[model samples]
Target chain A: MAKSFRDSLEAGFTITAEIPPPKSVSFPKSIEVAKKVAGKVAGLNVTDNQRGMMRMSSMAFSHILLGVGCDPVWQICCRDRNRLALQSDLLGASALGIKNVCVMTGDYPTLGDNPGAKAVYDLDAVQLMKLTDGFSNGKDIRGGVMKNHPDFFVGGVVNPFYEPIELELLKLQKKVNAGAKFFQTQPFFDIESVDTFLEQAKPSGAKMLIGVTPIKSMKMLKFLNENVLTKPIPDGVSKRIEFASDQMMEGLKISAEFINGIRDRVDGAHIMPINQVASLPLLLDMVEEGNGA
Target chain B: MVYNAPAMIITKKKDFEEILFAIGDTRSLFLLGCGDCATLCKTGGEPELKEMSQKLVAKGIAVTGTAVVPAACHELDTKRVLRKHKDEVDKAQAVLALICGAGVQSVGDNTDKPAYSGCDSLFIGNSKRQLHYYEKCSACGECVLNDTAGLCPETRCPKSLLNGPCGGAVGGKCEVNSENLCVWIDIYNRLKKAGKLENLLLKISAPKDNSGLAKPQKLELKREPGR
Candidate 1:
């Protein structure tokens, strides 16, 4: 059996992958993808309506992954639920034996299908982590004691590419103080660009996992460059995929190379497949082979 | 009675068709407008009242009468204004208020007939000039203006982030609405200028206690028994 996600983090080098839950009720395909990368990664993180698009609740999907013997990182966000619902969901996740959680202030509601939906950001990311910390101490947010409280491994996100990088570093410090055990950063393709962020963050003593998403085509590269990334994709990285005969394989190679370059600098890598979950096992193999060479 | 207060209670007119649909079967209508905030917004002024009255007349609905209340949000003032036009108020089946939410409710509370709002209450704002306004406060019930160097993240930042700026800001502009500068960055600069950056860096804001946002908020000032 795979080591628990906490053990993997403490062991120094770890690998995790994020799988978005399905939009529809059925999740056989998601389970199958989780099974494929079961032993290959330290944990599988199921996203909570990533990009503001509604999907199956990450809690339900993570529970399913846990049942299949995969360590599941249940991601919870503050966009849809107020504090009451957030607290209730945390207790529910604990009752269901979902041990690891990644907290975020999810994408705004208008970015996805439901532009008319109201956003409820009652608690930001740091506050959510603080709430999770409260759970581990057997105290609810109101200071009332519960008969049995949850023991959770809490995590948060950082955006290394965000300019005024001081702002990002400050939030990183806050998250660390709020009891974030580890962090998964926003997708970064270059290692050197984030060195300043890593240097500033090292004092916090929180484990850092660099986020990587393997691009499958030119169109995706363009979309991410224009709409997603704060800093545009490095010209060299973009050109390699743009000019490649087989862009998919080239994209996989770029991700592996990027991971291999940063593995020694950071704690580990978080592979966000971006709807390409089936390619994860193969991508992991490529990274391993490159490290061996 | 002269003051330099920015402004309050900005409102915008809803589509005429929607208003028409809302007042179905009410052939006779009494139009009510506010002389202060709504008049400044141009949605409820003498011209707008006359324009609305004409539109209703063109729609084959009788215009019973119209009055611009000096302060429609004041319940007593609204009642006094309606009394001046009691004959018109009795002839009209319903009262259509072209003012802010508080003004509409005041009219509703003071009248027996159905009351409908002809405008959407936007936000408490500053009038840069006539017909040009910008939202200044969201009335979140808790103010953080001191920490932010006098800029309101609650009213300005789309995310209402308390700790700091989110990752989406680029070129000091917000990702949600690119036209607006990221208020946090502005706050940071202001704090740096004010030599209070350490306070922001050192403190982690607790989650807001939103209980104050509970609906139907009421306030009753205690007073001496015999003043």
Candidate 2:
């Protein structure tokens, strides 16, 4: 059985980090970074086709993480493979010793360099979780066949600050019914929206971890404000990131403080650095000081 | 030393997928690419094989391995290739062949793994890249092209009469109601262009021995050096 959120969080703070697959055949530096983050985070989430560049397969990277004594959450997408292939791969993943899988409907391949390749979407996110329900019961995907199954802790993602909170909650309920044990949502910008999603998700037993992608530059802040989900940069927060102070160091410190403002309401935080995996220690320190208050 | 009515058809990628799905996970997959026919068609080429491999890999399916030899139908070549990848092929629960019927049988004879055709075969022996196929030949394949102005009146002319302006030629097209121009009309137009229209009316139907007309005459040739 998968551990409950309260039981899983033995320590007061549960920090999970993101690890991107390496760009080359060999991954010494990537593995080293994974080992470093494992010491500070509860588990490392290995991305699959992140931003659509072909990288080392996520399963192989997951195995590497597990070898180095780090918990690896395999990110599974419904972008490329069809139902038969997805079903087969899920079984193969369980055989290869991966326990945690996060299901998401990945980005369209045209978003990446490969524009000509076709995307085989055999199943969407909710259907995939339904397909995986067999594993939770120790039965194969066929439901009649019995096979060695993975002790999976399945999770889904949602964006609270995303507009139309009712629709998002409906989908969230569907994911929970489809057997998602936890939710890793888009970042919490407005405390009210975070409070709103939490109150809605209070009934579902799935643990909710707030996804935080830190905004560093004005350009990045703009990108997050515009591109990242539908999260509105409330007026006071925009003024803070724009003119918190003339000094960038002062502005970043203020931004860090802003993230700290809503740390209490979440079970944990999933920090996406984009490409700043090395700066995780600083971000974690900021969160620690924020929580220490 | 000639071909008549040779027919060949090609299958698509969906066909390959359907065949693979028929042989599910219970079977191991061994893909053998032919060095000759499949290689020429580029269907079972190394690049396509690697692509298939990657497709299977991304799905986390275990395939025995892929191997192409001089000729999948050649017993010696297939034997050597199978032996080289034997361990991986043995791991494959099933064997798939991207070769013709003969090649499939050749590999099947040597190993116990069931061999399946990767490409569909549709030829009754007369396979040619001719501009157009001839349903029958009188083999009086004599110098007819020269007199007929390069349009064979014997075979292509549906009327089979060695005469011009057969009243079936309309608007320089066929009145046999064909999408094609009547061969006699084309002969007339071309001959007229070359000032040789007189040669077509040469009154030449020398007791056309067409007992063999629109029929098949079976004969054997040395298709391969030994066979």
- How many clashing pairs per prediction, in order? 0, 4
User: How do the residues A152-246 of candidate 1 rate in per-residue lDDT, one tens digit apiece?
Assistant: 99998888876677767777888888888899988888877768668878887999988899999999999988887877889988899989999
Give the interface RMSD of candidate 2: 34.1
Best by DockQ: 1
Give all candidate RMSDs, comma-separated: 2.0, 25.4
Worst 10 residues of 1 chain A by lDDT: A161-170
* Cα lDDT of model 2 by residue, B40-67, tens digit: 5555557656776676666566667898
Off by over 4 Å in 1: A291-293, B1-6, B223-227
Residue pairs whose backbone atoms clash in candidate 2: B6-B126, B28-B92, B28-B93, B28-B94
lDDT agreement with native, every candidate? 0.87, 0.64
TM-score of each: 0.95, 0.52
